[model samples]
Target: MESTSSEYARFLAYGNQLIEVHIGLRDLLADLREGVVPAAELGAHCLAFCAAVTRHHTGEDTQVFPLLAARDPGLRSFLAGLEHDHRIIAGLLTRAGAVAAELRDGSTADGAARLRQELDVVAAVLETHFIGEEKRLVAVLNAIDPSVGLTALTDQAVEFR
Candidate 1:
């Protein structure tokens, strides 16, 4: 089994990756807001951001949450809440994606305005969800046995697509 310290380090690394991607998405959204990104690329950028978030959530739901549930039944409710947040986030992503697809020519005043609104909703919810998850599970995750590794938690193979 991996030492608790080592596992904690790994969990922190994963958290950092999540932060990095979140910042990247925010930066892209800011560019979109500034009307700098071409309309043709907006959809792709949105898709990438959504994909990353989906992968992270799917990883938690399938790999991390299950383990946490099995290890501590008391966490079931908390995990369920996180899962609910995932669904909400997924819906928000879908909404944003549709808008992005419509922006094929470049951002218009109305489209940009609408997209900003959608992204704001996404960002608000995601910030809450991410913080709640870290508060509730980061320590538990770090204590998991090294034998039953958490590689799956950080894996992107099991997608939400």
Candidate 2:
């Protein structure tokens, strides 16, 4: 069977993949907080989450946001806000990663407490950023030329690659 999907659908799928990664990180953090995941694994998990978010945000800033801004000047303010959110999330992720790195064992009371708190903040900020982005940009994305070649953005942001 031949399947045809619009660029908007493809883009949304890509964005959803990033969101799912955030969700997975949230779950992992929750497990860490509950002592379900081994404490020693927390640092590696934090680093992986940080990498995924950096890649996703970099793709958006370099590819998706620039194209959208050029095509629709009215979106400039919204994109700016999103960019600001990205910076904030980046800081939170960095702090979380640092705290995670300090965790010698999941049983480390102070380090685990700090890392869990940092992850909680990251998850909250990410939730807000993702929802706001989808609300503001999904329709615009759908309206963009389907052949505009967003392969770089999608390739980097999507996990299945």
Candidate 3:
């Protein structure tokens, strides 16, 4: 049985992948500034990053969040906030994707600067959301045995409630 800490640790590692996207975006921005990374490559990277984010989010929304929310009634408000924050951040990423596509097409359009701006917006929102989520979820970690926690969290998501 994995410990509660172990499962949370796993999820936290997943969270870090989103951070990696932010890092990648910044790197791409640097490339854009230097004309080193082709716009097409950057657009593809952004799309892939977004896809990864969608998967991480699906697991959290469909599996992780439901388990945590059911077990902790006190977290209901915070959970709602988290969901809202996710939508906000996603919007920013969508904008970045648009700008990236434009850039990749070599359109004289103001894509590079717009992409950089949107990326910053999404990154800032995501940072705040992750901080709040960690603060709330950390206490629940280790509150139950690892096996029970993982099973309840991943399998049924409803049993915890």
lDDT-best of 1 and 3: 1
lDDT by residue for model 2 (69-143), tens: 766789999999988898998888888877776774454568866877887788778778877876667667656
lDDT of 1 by residue, 88-159 (tens): 999998898777666644555466567767877887787787677766665555455666554444433222
Model 2 misplaced stretches (Cα beyond 4 Å): 1-34, 104-109, 145-161
- Find the number of clashing residue pairs for candidate 1: 1
> Highest lDDT: which candidate?
2
Overall local distance difference test of candidate 1: 0.68
The list of candidate 3 runs beyond 4 A from truth reads: 1-40, 145-161
Q: Model 2: clashing residue pairs?
A: 39-106
Give lDDT per model, in order.
0.68, 0.69, 0.60
The candidate, 2 or 3, that scores higher on TM-score is 2
Q: On lDDT, who's better, 2 or 3?
A: 2
Residue 70 CA displacement from its true place in model 3, Å: 1.4
Model 2's alpha-carbon lDDT is 0.69
Backbone clashes in model 1, listed as residue pairs: 2-146
Cα error, residue 105 of model 3, in Å, equals: 2.6
